[model samples]
Target: MNHFFRKPILLITATLFSGSIINAQNVGIGTATPQLGKLEVKGSTGAVSAIFYDQSTGVAIENNHPGIGFNSYYNGGRKAIAPGFGGLLGMDPASGKLHIYTAPASIATAGAPMLLTERMSILANGNVGIGIAAPTAKLDVAGNLKIADGTQGEGKILTSDELGNASWQSGASLVPGASIGYGTWGDCATNGNIGAYQPLTGAAGVNNFGKSVSLSGNYAIVGAPFETVGSNYSQGTASIYRLDGNGWVLMQKLTDATGAAYEHFGSSVAISGQYAHCSYCRRPRRKWRAWFCNHLSIQWQHLAAAKNYANQPCKPGFLWQ
Candidate 1:
């Protein structure tokens, strides 16, 4: 049974029993006037404001789903929180789905109501949704996602490691240079084949590139016998490449400086280790000239030294017909 005591000006009512006070429909502790809601407790300096204790041993909400609800009469609405042994649990009562919401501001005054935005949701079937209410997949997100692991780039793709960890990686750039064919002369002339190596600078032209090619380990040398240098037609050149993470990259372009037009400097090429040799028919000397380039240094000044092997006997592997 509760009794009411009416003050002259305040009109206060209360029923006190064993230090507990109940006034009409409102309950107040350490305060006579509870202005905010039905139940209010005003705590002093050295004490805790409020505490919710659960007696359950396991990590689950066993009994009734008890929660505190907040509502406003203005434009905004209600936000409920259910505190339990499994941390803070927020759920939609009608759908029984776990929903997480965030408010833009901390406080909401009289006229201006608080707006709550739902950020994440976990369905009853264990499907998680981000930026969306209903999820069709196991983990569904409506917005764009970025995985920054230092290997991500614009033109890269995701690749998995040995342990199934994924990271962004670059693929080889297949810039078409020329076509190579195999078989008899009639078959090579009629059927067009596919495959080529990248040029030193830009795209390769109608020059007879890949007419002669030599490979030594991860290094390769290709001959462009009909390549024109400056005003000299068919002066010819050879390109050397080294294989790396980004496929074969052009290292240097080899050419005979003292050779004249129609000499075809890179007619035939051979590469053994770091040494590269290129031979061509010298029409002026009526004999073949070869440039034995020693890639022993990074400067690549060895290609400038041309050697005339006119009188010397032709070595078996070095000189290819």
Candidate 2:
């Protein structure tokens, strides 16, 4: 008899459970008639709409929600609304801080569903990241940022004004022959020959002076690769000049100690600090060499001299200063 009564009670419990499942519909937490969604929570002015708590893990999870959660508070008789702001809200189990994420929206169609893009999250450590999953700094952006002010140009720099506003400003000029207001004004062909000085003796076409020139500090070097020395033709020479007061005075003339005919000694010239470098390219013997000069001690030293092998082609060599 006891077993027969227990069987009837089990059948009644199963019938009542199935009925509850069939009658399940939209649930309204604080409203009489909820919206078309599965669940809806409504609040009054100056009041929080909902608060979820999970005592098991100390983290709350809200899924498939629309609109911002904590932005509906009244402020100074004004209601500021943030539209289309919805995401997941959770609490970090370790730090107990809130984490908010903006959820991606979607649109349903007959063929496919299109998802709308949105920002990811604000981390529990207060770091915000855009276009990145993990941010290592305070505000980390993984993409390029372009400032679209009308005053900016190609090579201009971004600068801040006294009012703390940032704008673009012109950078420093870096072009050669830029006049910066510190030179005497006169034409090259008609300068009154104020401080002009040339070789004491040279014919019209033989003197190829000022072919190569280098200036550093107060020193200048000029090369003449076709200047004749004694009876030799094209025995090149170099001249060093110093800036004395407002004029350039010739300090010394440099020539190879064992200079021969057709050796273009001063084809290239460079100066740095108190030293000068000159090159000699001997075309006939296929030989190339460079010499170093110390302007302070008035000493010359042969640094490199190399002769190409017979029947071997050669290219122009470079000398480092």
Candidate 3:
């Protein structure tokens, strides 16, 4: 029974085995068999580079409280995941928190995750909003964004998506002579609401503009520089349509407010609000563009076309480029 030192070797083996069990307990994990006490681990050194605790091969230390049984150490720390492609599964965006995903099938509100998202950006209230993105999209919430529903646009909503061209929506009140659609906001009251898409050369010629495509209010006053110097802006006619009980109904076709013709589009009516304002380029390029003032006589003698004017403040009758 007492050969040499058999008991000492047995004691050494027992001590090592006991140490493994104690380590597992500290990490709150179960042993090889289920229902054992939790196993835990502490960092020997203060700093650890790796984030998540790897337990793929580690033992499942047992837990005896409520709910699910086994527990294992997962190194979900402050940052959650690498900055590269972290999702809701990432560590907390805030400090001292861990991100957790709720069970898909189970009704655990523990960590409710939003569906249909590759990555989630936190809102001001810490709630998540859904956003589909393209490759060229940037990831940031630069400023305040508003969301509204059920509120219709203030005026006439002219959509051109059906026409396969530039779509536009103008207010109910339009003005006369204002050549809308890149040309000019054919005359209207208040400020000319630019149509969605306008002609680059709508003011003087046709299809003769290389300006970058853009959108403006009222009449879609597009590419032309500010000062178009011409006497006759009568060629540009403004038509008004109302959305009736059935469909869009043409209300009126105002050929001329002064009953005279200027340049085919001369310095005619500029559309704004629900009216038009037109004047001689020589008068005041800004005033004549979108002003809707009551006047019987549009003196052709005073009117002139826009020649060289670009980017100016829009008045009641005009819009700044």
Top candidate by lDDT: 1
Count of backbone collisions in candidate 3: 96
Whole-model lDDT, model 3? 0.31
Local distance difference test, each candidate: 0.61, 0.55, 0.31
Compared with the true structure, what per-residue lDDT tens digits does model 1 show for residues 8-107? 7867788554223455556676677766668776652222234433442122221122222232111123322222212223666677788765554554
Q: Give all TM-scores, in the order shown.
A: 0.36, 0.35, 0.22
Point to the candidate with the largest TM-score.
Answer: 1
Q: Which portions of model 3 show Cα errors greater than 4 Å?
A: 1-117, 125-267, 272-276, 280-321
Better of 1 and 2 by lDDT: 1
Per-structure clash totals for the candidates: 0, 0, 96
- Residue-wise lDDT of candidate 3 within 78-129, one digit each (tens)? 1221111122333333442222232223222311322223333433344442
Among all windows of 10 consecutive residues in model 3, the one with the lowest summed lDDT is 62-71
Candidate order by decreasing TM-score: 1, 2, 3
Where in model 2 is the C-alpha error above 4 Å? 1-186, 189-205, 297-321
lDDT of 2 by residue, 1-321 (tens): 355444444444333221111124766656667655667655543433444433211112222232233222222221213333233344445553444444254213211222223344456777776766566777778888788768777766675522346766554445577543322434322443222333332235675677778988557788887888887688888887765433456778888877788776777898876778788766566476666777544443444444444544334444212
Better of 2 and 3 by lDDT: 2
Reference-based lDDT, residue 56, model 3:
22
